[model samples]
Target: MINLHWIILLPIIFGTVVKLLPLKTAKKLMVLFQAVLLVLVFVIFIEVRKNGTILENIGGWPDTISITLRADLLASAMALLTCLLFLAMLTFVQNKHYADHLFFFLFLSLESLIIGIFLSNDLFNIFVLIEAATLIITILIMYKKTNLSIYDGMMYFLINVVAMSFFLMGLGMLYKKIGVLDFYALETALSQVKDPDSMILPYAFMITAVSLKAALMPLFSWLPKAHGTPSAPSEVSAILSGLYVKTGVYLFIRLQLAFSPLINTSELFMVLGFITAIVGFVLAFAQTDIKLLLAYSTVSQIGLIMVGINMGSPQAYWGGLYHIMNHAVFKSTLFLTAGMIITEYKTRNLDEIKGVFNLMPAVGMATVISILGIVGAPLFNGSISKYLISEGSSGSWIEYGLIFINLGTIIVFIKYGQLLFGESGKKETANSDILEKAVVLGLSMLCFFGGIFGSELISILFEVNFPVEILSHGVKLLLFVGSLFLGLVIYYGLFKKKNYLAVLNAIELGFNEICLSITLFFAFMVIYLKITL
Candidate 1:
């Protein structure tokens, strides 16, 4: 029987063909194709749930040149989230002014690469898929034909290609030692190897490369610039912040599991995650542009996810994975909504765009839900994972660090809430269409219900004790009251003061670059140790 791996490539192939079709017909065909793809994904999700871990070896090749596609619990959950987000984005972009054929082609190509990354079992194949995704994303970023978009795309391409080169070098080292590229085979080889010395170089290189790709601080400078730019489509922002970055996290988890014995390096991950979380939010709080604020917030959220995974408990792992799904939903929704607001208001500045909620209730409501989710407010999907991550942690320092970051998240979103609700008198509502409203409503519903029943849903998917008590009663109330107060204080007191915009610009350009250089130096130290020790 043929495997579902082949099915993963269908969208890409179809998307390319669609791009070649007449522009008038392309939009209709793209929507129809994406709708069908969504249905197929749902069917695949069902099949995977019924039968544990679907794996297919291509061309009957068991050991060499075998392309393996497998869906574990994590992969299925991610795929589901991706498909849903993609659908919402499609709806939003369907009516917007753009080359419909090219846009859909790039979008589907991105989807194909993401699926390929998630489902593949070979390290080499994962690298290839990641490169493919990056190339497609670069094209998407530059698709708008603006100077800012072109510059951002070039920067993104250069940085990511460098990162991938390091990853390829690491893969080469691993292949030299093990003679196999499959993750399972590499795991077996590492377990069988006697000397730990030979393993350290490849391991360190791989981890660093993954960290860079994932946008862990201080390697996160490129992200805010690349993701914060206005030239890319809103849907592309969703994919970049939502699904694409998570690929690195997934690889980290898989590798950590495979090399559990040789690699007891969670402490490094913990420290890096803590710093990243703190820095991310601090930077986020300083941004004037709403999209940049949200982009930095993504950095902070990704940091929190890493903290959960680095905690090294099964509960932490589960929470990390759960948060991945929740973050994707909320973050993508928020970005899309932001795009809608920008499209309507003709401005990305929060100060100029007053009384937005009064103008677009649907968009406002969606933004409110997404903000609450990010803040870990009660009965929301984000709170469940946040609670799990915090309580699942054993160390006091780590737990407290997470709490402080959560507080900072509250502060950042509080500014957003203030911008939405506080500055109400200014008129001038930008015109918006029906499709935009539909997109916002669709995502809002997901975040709302996803929060309300997160525990039950995750429990069924994970087949573990979902810890409803902490999620329902404890963290929700604490975060709500705490964040609300912090937000009020920060907005009313601090942010209302002088020209912090210059400071924010400096941080975005100067400080972040310094941090990135420092991180690269540390990575080099690890390489040096591998060579010497």
Candidate 2:
């Protein structure tokens, strides 16, 4: 008998098997396993494209009694991107083996959990996968056993545990009401109900948890500590900023659709997105460490994605979805490049590092391409997707909101771009790997060319026609250039001179404060849902 379940189970089995093998064998096995998983993604992609949505009920039982694995355009596309990304990342760490067997096991397990999330159509499975992912990430974040890493890892773990508690409570409420934990069944059950407001409590609980997972405002401190900390591996940070956070976003979209009939909180999220975007940039500007800068930048980009998807416009929604992929490539590559830079320079301080283009030509060039992509320059992926998002926001206040967010993004990136200039007379500071450099170059090339065919991509992915009209292209480019110029002026004239960055940095909140913030966010959501839904 043919098996469709292998797509979800095979990698997990491989991860479990690796734990029994020797460290060297486990590493090779993982690389091979990742290749197999990537191939499966392609196979599933073709199957999904041809058949629409593929579903598998476990144990050949009734849908209500068994777990379900699902594959659709969104799920398959993300899975494919994720597998390719992880495979490429594995190649980067081929030479530097730290923590030996444990790292590989944890990393592979995390992959399985993420893939499981993409495929599962059951609430319990999704929650379990998320909790599993969170656990694995916390361990990885503390892999080095440094004082800071331990602190950061604990912060991440404790904060997410609290969030997952909210998620579990929501699941309890859901099961109590519908008696089924499956997505389709729950949606069906919810639709048949007369009063949508009766579901508001569970909805608020779940969405709040997902919002925290996405690292929205007031609950995002755990992110920089985990992803931006000096002790986290480059691969760990890359995957977190590039892929894992997108898992939260995926749930955001998925749950939003499943519960659309009950409530529409898109406007609230749109406003929150703008706030996140602005705050993310401001925090980024305050960071002196390059890693922390990129960390906060991830938060800002997620905000932009949130705004695009919540706008209720097809072009914007697809653009946001497409951005999930684009951001993965560019941001992952940037983190990898930063790792290479930090290794070469022996420090993470931005002030001490300069003239990247001259010092490390290959890594520096890739970083340049990545900067272009992140800043939405013409002929880059970010530009096209952002264009779509902005177009969809036109004639609404959201249009202006996006513009301001873009401006803030440019200002912080302006500070980041400074690392690229100056003369090169220095020698090689750290040993380099051909495979690592090659992967960065390849991803950057994708960043560059993905934009050339951006419209075609949008059309194919969402089955919608979003042509890049010349006028729209010209206008967006002009606006981007203006933003770039203004960002430079502000960075040099006011932000740097007035010690604004100092104030933001000094206003740090502790774990207790973060917990308080999470509580406040949930309470506010509960009240808002009650009034609106």
Candidate 3:
């Protein structure tokens, strides 16, 4: 009979307890802890789905005065994903040499903080948890202490510190106006207010931070460095790309919905999303580093997800949510597999590494499945989510924009697919752990079948009957196939013929540069939102 309130406490307590244990004992304890957490999250999910929502004001205090946590379908689902992803990471890292002290401490603490961010009903708590998570992640990112990793970690820290300052300022403003930071309480306060204009700046402040975290355009300067640094381990990169960033997206959904009665900026966000998506793929196309290419691809996929959710269509909203899950699975698998490939080849350059299929057949096969999913091949997870997102914008420019952006993604991957061909070079074998391989391959299969039975899976995951239209009777199939062919042509015919992409590779933003970009974006958002929303 454990309620939602105890769920947050369980992780935080165990995470702290692990800090005191010996290294070997900590690892053993962690497995047990993760098992308990998985069970707890499952139980919470069941209870939430059964009851619709679970609200707990701590210590049985009055709702008006006490801090509260909520467990609805969305929050519970996200929490469950967090648990599953954390466990997957542990299994991946278990045999790695870096599984030393502070590894468990940082990961477990970060895990609890993330779950808290998802579950907490109070804005103040969310802010604190996010800041804590950022600090821990920064430390983890710089863990290897190799090749500019310290610099990358510092940049990540400085940029996010500024972002959190924005969040804090906005939280202060909201508290001044509403006298409470609880989501429901804020809504209640807004209901009694006459002026909604005061919220625009606060929204700008908060959303800018969340947007930075989500690595949206302009503020996306930190993402490539942090997620693709040569020093950051594969699991760290995978977790950052696969899960940490989504917490920001989660906050965006939560805060925006709470302010729906005040204003709607979905249209502006849709436009911004399109720009981000296009830019993301274009930048990815110019990259030679496989990990960086994947990092940029994440930016592209996130933009598409942002576009989906902002489209004022329920089909799009659900599609966006579905894509979040899909992106997590496939992207993590790609990053992990890419990490292995990079290790085996002893290089990060996409062109230098070849014949993964011959060298590591399982890894190569996983890459093919992951690529198909990312490129939205029929009966893959990406296709289902992409099609649903398209359904919402059926005839608009946004739909067309998705096609164009996807073309860019296809071109990048077409270049990336080169690794699967050519000669399997001479190199000594390394221990390929059965567990890590199984986890990633299993996830790839989930992507495969998840698309084949998308409607059923969607109903199970979301508890709603979602009609999944695949290729829309060959119309979408034609478009995707055309894009793939065109992308390949552009890659070989146009890109290969020129040095133009070199300039794109040189565009790296510094800390001050990122700060300026954030300022410009905030100002633009304020002016534009004032005029429009």
Candidate 4:
């Protein structure tokens, strides 16, 4: 098997080399380098499949104390996802005017850091990677350098830096108490510790940081701005939504697992997740700007993914993982195509942007499919993941909560679907770059393929023999159809004429308010664990 360090280092090396080259040469080399990285990630995935889990300590150091890289099913899969999304983004942006060497350099550097986050087993290393990635993403978010962009970027930077301080403090606390930061070692150590309650503060601190990163509830005030800022390029928005935010979810899973023996906050996260989902869609439903709508939609879906993962069932956990992959594909497609549409129409308002089929057939087609996938329409990837998650929570109130979330998802997308009709009012032809069109379409097709073969893919990906009975659950089908029409009724009746919910879109948290939210969230977690534990 290939060394895990190389997978992390090769991209940085390639990016540095590309930065020193001329623009045209740099673009070509960038693609070549990302392809190489993707191949290497695939190899790591294969090796993990064959060997169960691959762990290596840097510089031949011992596992307990050394900086270690661990390749298990989830890590390898996320690494693969990082590479695929990077490669697609690279291809999608190759022909753009702003596709410069510096942009390529930052893009590749961020890719490496994200993959590093996936592979690193050392808590401090993960912290450094996240902090580094946070800086790069802030730059990318404000890459256009407008005054507003600079302000938006700074807001993102300030909030995340504050969040990471908690992470650093928690790391210090763990290292002081346990003297090790490696994931498995910490898990083992915690298992042996007599008083689990003693670790609750550290757990609360670390989880607060991750929850903010995952854009849970009150901490999500920054997500829409960071993701939907006009200064950010479409590809940057795509990466932020499609892959970067997922790092938070990934770390949330890891941190929870490491502390599982000591505490189980599954119930807390589930409630938070459901609230986040509801709030996300309610805000998304009121958006006029297409990109902001998509951004808020991401918040909603992440919450749904959290709900699935914390449903206390193996089926739901795997389904959450699958939905992660599904969201990456469709959301990337939507963001990329939304960029194209905004470019063509010279506006971001959903009401103004119409006749997409006539204006850009390929992008329109991709958008429709992606919307279907996101809405959990039957025979789409979202449906499959929702099915698994729902099946896992059968006969429970959580199952009904899942239903309500899906209904909100459908309603938001139904509002989003308005872009596909009416007139674009422009004389431009649907002559977008063939490569960009192909990338979007490819992602859209994966959404379909994922649904059709979801069962097999889930089994193979997670090494579980879970078969999904789509036809067996006739009620689910009925529920899905019912939700779609009901969503339509709700969208038209409640939202179309005079959107009372539109005021929700204007609500923004000031930096001070956001800080208070983080503190409140931490206090709540600490108190909840105190009462529950």
Candidate 5:
């Protein structure tokens, strides 16, 4: 029923209506509503698993005229990941210093838009929801009022809105050609077209726009700046890095599914993904600020996910999706732990900070587990995803590329380990100790145990046969040893020297801007050729 759509609207509507209420009460109510929404997402996840897909058409209109909400396997997986990330964020922010009501409102609004993005079966609807998300996130970025926050927020707004414009134009062109905006309709129309190349304009445009949103390669400049700026409330950063960026990835996947025949080059995605991964880690390794390091790490992780999808094998698709979920959980945990650390120490600089583990052992343990998960240590979620991704890669070159990315991930996390557990001389207190320990313990358990059971979880969730070869014991041991060795090499060779960081930073900044411009130019050229040729 259309009422299902109302579930998303509940928090937004209530938050707006209660704007004048006491901020504390409003915040509590919003959190309560989000909990209900989380439950609803689980219900939908179960129902979709049982029924194949769930579709809701607004106002009793048929699928063609009404907006449609549908949940496929991919959508359900994303939704579940989102809910979990939201739960972590809520927990992390329970006693934080931010404006509770505004924070909750923004959080719910972002979640609603994300859910809308996943649920919508129509291209136009996806565009609208993405726009909504952009606006809400922009406000969230600007909420801090710092120079960096405002500047980065503006950059994010400008770039994404520009991309959204391209999306709208592409949708308009498709609608004009096919007289419909639904995925099925557009697919049908494109399938019947004699010149598939003609559709490249829209495809390029849409992909470019979504890539910017996803922080893939060149369009990623705004990400590190924005994400690193506001102190991002830990859990919010987790969601931003964890699930928000995946919106673009999901859109790209949906596009590929609907228009695979029209797409000529999967190599572009593969190559770009590889570049992003390498560049992201290089920059992350250079960052003195811990938040920036994690932010750049996101860029690298996303690249790995994209490369998995670009491989175009069933194994890769499953792996990509699995990685998406895995990244969300562990990444959120990492960010939350980072937040707790920063809150206690009141700094983001890694060099100045000393042995925090001494102050907060629980958080220290959690941080270690999260770093292990990110670096693909054995029996963690990262290993599962990394194995699948590597297995899905076709040529030796791509496999080697994957290996390099893995090495970079290992190296960056080694630096993270140094900062998290190294030499902070801060003293631990009785009160801060308990809270920090609790949060760390919970997240660490998830990172370590969750990885061990990830295969079983994926099998049950997707109702598909997960390949045993990819998850074999030998492969796990190899990855563990290889990654550990790589970490040690980087730690002794590069991080200890501390000379490559500046070079890596400059390269990342330059590469991101260049890629963004080139992609946008390519899209524009395609559109021009379509019009004039």
Candidate 6:
């Protein structure tokens, strides 16, 4: 019988073998390895669908005592995403010099850790997986060995280490209070608690850690540095922006669900999510470097996802989950194509690059499709999820907030959309990498099909039916068109002539400031919980 543990174990075991093999041999072997791993993930996903949820206790110990691996619909979906992205990224970079044995080892090792995180039902086990993943990512960030890269890596490492300490402390407190680290067990115990106050401190601690991981509002300072660092490979950036950072959001969902009985702070997160969304777009519009633009955009989209998740309705909550998948596909494509553009043009500045459609049609087409998807164009994946979130938030200020956020997204992308048009002043079309182009095109197609069949996909993915009515869909389409027109005018009329956004981008938070922000965030959460509960 195929087991969940093998899904986590195969990568590590094979990665070791690949690491010791000759470079050429290892390169070919790793592809096959990823293919096999993808199959395993598919099998597990199928099993999860057949059964409600799969549960296993290591060494046959009782569920409350042993490490637990649980694969429900949510976990299975996320695990499938993990496998698919790792395979895409690995394949995307196969022909590059960077796809060496050690790199492959670290990549697959990170994959194993992330999948472990998705499957683990024990709180301590999840923490350990997160910590291990962090270490692997640090190495990957500084893989190129530059001063700037090293600085980015160390800052990422140090800040995350400090943040995860809080997670560990919270876990210690929870284990002490509940006598078990299993998620289900903890939930049962928490439901029996008479006072919500007792869990506040630990909740604050663990949530602070997760918020940082999720790049929520003030805790997101480390994200751009880690994701947009020029020294890192494009595939690394793609995975980081596309999937890795999402682990934080995923954890936030899991932890919040586990703590739902004792804590209810949806209002607080909703506010923060809105702010993060606004700030993310403003920064993205100001960026000259291509990667930083995408990085800040990730921050903005994550904030939007957070907003949807906390909208206090099933439609919006599941919409938020669906957006996670949408963002993963679109953002991954953007990053991958950006890498190709940067390589072809030898410039990361947006001003110097143009006529991508004329020079590289395949890549240009992919970029255009992804940009459309992200802007929530009427027939794109983003539109479907955004509409669902709006539907859930209908008849309130939250609805208006969603509109403004979408407008801001349009404005930011309008600036980026320039890359697809105009003349590059070059005569020859650049040779394309077939594999890379294929991957990019495939993901871009997903962005379109995901939107076209959004309702059906949501139903299939989550086993829930919340169909989009035609009248409502038409209204959203009108709203999207209005937003797009306004965004274009704002981008061309005001932003094109002025550099005000550049000033906004100049504001950078240092390490000390980030730590201070973390402290303030925790304090605010604690105080809010005390009053609200």
TM-score of 1: 0.93
Clashing pairs in 4: none
Whole-model lDDT values for every prediction: 0.79, 0.86, 0.85, 0.90, 0.75, 0.90
- Model 6 residue-pair collision total: 0
Looking at candidate 2, the ten consecutive residues that score lowest on lDDT are 423-432
The TM-score values for the models, in the order shown, are 0.93, 0.96, 0.96, 0.98, 0.92, 0.98
Predicted candidate 6 versus true structure: per-residue lDDT over 139-206, tens digit per residue: 99999999999999999998999899988999899888879878898889899999899999999999
Cα-lDDT of candidate 1: 0.79
- In candidate 4, residue 533 scores what lDDT? 88
Model 6 local distance difference test score? 0.90
Model 4: lDDT equals 0.90
Clashes of 2: 0
Worst 10 residues of 6 by lDDT: 497-506
Clashes of each: 2, 0, 0, 0, 5, 0
Candidates 3 and 4 compared by lDDT, better number: 4
* Model 4 agreement with the true structure over 436-521: per-residue lDDT tens digits: 99999998998999888888887767788777664745778899899988988988887788777877866888889999999999
The candidate with the higher lDDT, 2 or 6, is 6
> Candidates ranked by lDDT, best first?
6, 4, 2, 3, 1, 5
Local distance difference test, candidate 3? 0.85
Worst 10 residues of 4 by lDDT: 465-474
**lDDT against true structure, model 5:** 0.75
Error of 2 at 485 (Å): 1.7
